[model samples]
Target: MKKNSINRVIGFVIVGLVLLAAVIETGRSVYTWSQQAAKQPRYTIVIDPGHGGNDPGKIGINDVPEKDVNLAISLELKEILEQNDCRVVMTRQKDEALYQAGDTNKKVADLRARCQMINDSGADAVISIHQNSFTAESSRGAQVFYRASSQEGKKLADILQTQLVSGLDPDNRRVAKANSDYFMLKNTTATMVIVECGFLSNSKEAELLTQASYQRRVAWAVALGVLQYVSGGLS
Candidate 1:
């Protein structure tokens, strides 16, 4: 073979080898990515924003509606959870009740519909958001409640309580409580929690809860708790 021809042949072989290696590497990368995706956690969560329409829950010091606050926080949490790859299902996305307009008993219909939605979702976790009230204005801080019979519920509640206290309300001394009598807790089949984000009766908390920034912060805390629970942090 001529010298120039031999050099050209060698270059061609080298180029072909490089291309082949690139193809193999690309395949390997794609396979690894698919495996990672398969292993990634896909948790389904049900977020229930308590009260709406005519049912303005627990009017606060400045007449801040608990229903509106719940919805706002739930929406923020849903957004964060979706971004983190969690499938979030919300009970009410707007300022409307779940019950039919002409229902004979609106409150009962609303509660039943919310419960049915939560049960049907087959969710890994269910969070019912609300604001608390007390006869005394000094009541504040967040509280988490779970079904008395469900171990999963307690675990979720504990994780959430810790997150809320640590991340949002550092001064919060409240802990998770078990309740078998609550309508949603007793009726819902999945692991469920009712998070009273704050005491709306307290003027300070009512003011904070009304602010969008504070609601966003509360959502972040709830999101962290949910991630920890589903990721087996407490397991």
Candidate 2:
């Protein structure tokens, strides 16, 4: 072959080898992901949508109630988890409170009832979804709170916080926090984390939280975090 032809042929061979390597790497990545997913323990999780019925929780800048936002995200997370072969138990599937009719101090009753459900379900983990509110309207991003005494809960929370910050809220600067004050987290027998999905007090975040696409993104990130925890990916 002529020198020019030989040079062209060598260049083509190098390009082909590079493409082949890329394809092999992609295949390896996919296989690894599938194997990890298959190795994940089948988990039963309790998804608590915080503050329903008379308890509207925080009111957002767009006038959307936090209860509704919480429920929306929880429902989406439930669907995603179920699709991944997880058994999901929802604390409340509707707008109604968990407390029975004519209950005195309905708020306390509602929380206690949720705790009972979490304990009775024998859940592997619990995710209580809520929207945050603050005196400052600039406060934004997702935050996760776990039981101070539960190491597994802290791990889960850390994974969730990482996923939320990296995938959904890239600007999020919050870290996973240990909170002993939340009734559900404090009382649940299972490893538990409370996800404050975003700040409803922030106009920008509140607008995003209300959108269905953003809700789905938040749910997907949470689901991935759960799967990662169960599969020992975080370890």
Task: Estimate the Cα RMSD of every predicted model relative to the unseen true structure.
Answer: 5.9, 14.2
Worst 10 residues of 1 by lDDT: 226-235
User: lDDT at 138 for candidate 2?
Assistant: 87
lDDT of 2 at 60: 96
lDDT of 1 by residue, 131-185 (tens): 9999999999999999999999999999999989998878899999999898988
RMSD of 1: 5.9
- Which clashing pairs does model 2 show? none
* TM-score of each model, paired residue for residue: 0.83, 0.81
Supply the global lDDT for candidate 2. Answer: 0.92
lDDT of candidate 2 over 45-111, digit per residue (tens): 8999999999999999899999999999999999999988788999999997888888899999999
